[model samples]
Target: MKMTDIEKQVGDFRLRIPQLQLEDGCIHGLIGGNGCGKTTLAKLMMGILTPDSGRIDREGLTGREITMTSQRPYLMHTSVYENVVYPLKLRGEKPEESDIRPWLTRCGLWKKKDQYAGSLSGGERQKLSMIRAMILKPKFIIVDETLSNLDPDSVKLFEQWIREIQEQSAVTWVLISHQLSHIYRMSDQIHFLSQGELVVSGPARELLKNCGEERLRAFLDRESLDRT
Candidate 1:
C-alpha cells in the first residue's frame, strides 16, 4: 500500500506528502520533528483525515483491517482483561479463555488483568493498548509513538514482540517514533518526513549513513547522543 502525492491543510499549514510505498510483511518507519505532520499523514493514511486531494492505493492490503495505536492509549471503561478482549468481541469472535490470558502474559500484563484499565500506568496502558490492537489480527498496524512512554526494558519487550508478530503473522507494521534507534532497529524500510513532506527514505542504515537533510541530520545527532 502507498500514499501518492497527498495534501491536507491543518489550519494555515499545508501538510503535503510525496509518494510513499509500504511493503507487506516489512516494518516501515515514519520519523520527524514535532509539527512535521507525521501524525497528520498517518491519520490521512488511516482514513481518519480527508485529504484535500490525492490517492491512497492499497496495493497489498485490503485496507479494512488496519489497526492503529497512539502515544496515549485509551481503554474502554472496563478491566484490563476486558480491554484486551474488546476487539475480539467487536468482531463477533468469541475469544476462548486460552486466547486472552496468553496475550496478556506476552504483553506482560497478565498479572494486572483484573485491574481497571484507567488505573494502569502510562507504559502499562500503552502496552495493553498495543496488545489489544494485535489481538484483532489486523493486516496493517500503525503505531504512533507507542513506545515513547515505556521504559527501556518495556520497550525491548515490545520490540521483541513486534519481531515475533512480523515472523508469525501476515501483519505489516508502520512504526512512528522519534526514537531513531528504535526506528533503526525495527524498520526494514523507512520514510522520513519534514514539514509534512517526505525528506528522505531508503534502507534504515543507508539513511543514517547519508542523512544530508538538515532536519534529519540533527534528529540523528540527537538520537545518537541519547543512545550514549
Candidate 2:
C-alpha cells in the first residue's frame, strides 16, 4: 500500500504526507516524539482515518488483509482461550482448543487458557492481544506501541515470538514503538514522523548514523540513554 499526496485535518491538527510507500513483506519502523503524528500517520495508512486531500493507492495490496494491533487490546468478559479464538470464530471458522493451544504455549499463556481474560496482568493482556491479532497471520499488520506495558522478560519473549513468526511467513509489519531499541531492532527501514510531518525516511542503521537534524539527533541520543 502507498499514500500519495496525503493531507488530513483533525480539528486543528494537520498531517501532510507527500509520498509514503509501504513495500511488500518488509518491516517498516515508525518513530517520533509524542504528538508528532506517528500514530496518526499509521492510522491514515491503515485507512482507519480518511485524509482530507490526496490519495492512498492500495492497488498493490490485493488478496490480503491489512490489520492493526493497538497498545491496549479490547477484550470481552471471557476465558483466555475464547479471547484468542474470537477473531477466527467471527470469520466463520469453528475454532477449537487445540487450534489455540500452540499460540498460548508460545506466549506462556497456556495455563491461563480457562481463566477470565480481564483478570490477566497488564503484560499478559498485551500478549493475549498479540495472539488474537496474529492468529490469522494477516498480510500486513500495524502494531502501535503494543509492547510498552511489558516487563523486560516478557518483552524479550514477545520479540522472539515475532522473529520466529517472520522467519516462517513473510508478512509486511509496521511497528510503532516509543522504545528506540525495539524500533531499531525490528525495523529494516525507519520512518520518523515529526510535528505532523514525515521528517526522516531511510534504512534504520544509515538513518541513525547519518542523522543530521538537531532535533532528531537529540531525540535519538535521549532514547539511547533511557534504553541503556
Q: Among all windows of ten consecutive residues in candidate 1, which has the lowest summed lDDT?
A: 219-228
Tens-digit per-residue lDDT, 76-170, candidate 1:
88899989777787888898878798889876788888999999999888999888888888989999998888989989988998888877885
Off by over 4 Å in 2: 60-64, 225-228
Candidate 2 residue-wise lDDT, 112-204, digit = tens: 999999999878888888888789778888889889998888788878877877898878889998888888777788888888888778888
The alpha-carbon deviation from the true structure for residue 165 of candidate 2, after best TM-score superposition, in angstroms, is 2.1
RMSD to the true structure for each prediction, in A, is: 1.8, 2.0
Query: CA lDDT, every prediction?
Result: 0.83, 0.83
Cα RMSD (Å) between model 2 and the true structure? Answer: 2.0
Quote model 2's TM-score: 0.92
Clashing pairs for predicted structure model 2, backbone only: none
Q: What is the lDDT of residue 90 in candidate 1?
A: 80
Q: Cα deviation in Å at residue 201, candidate 1?
A: 1.4
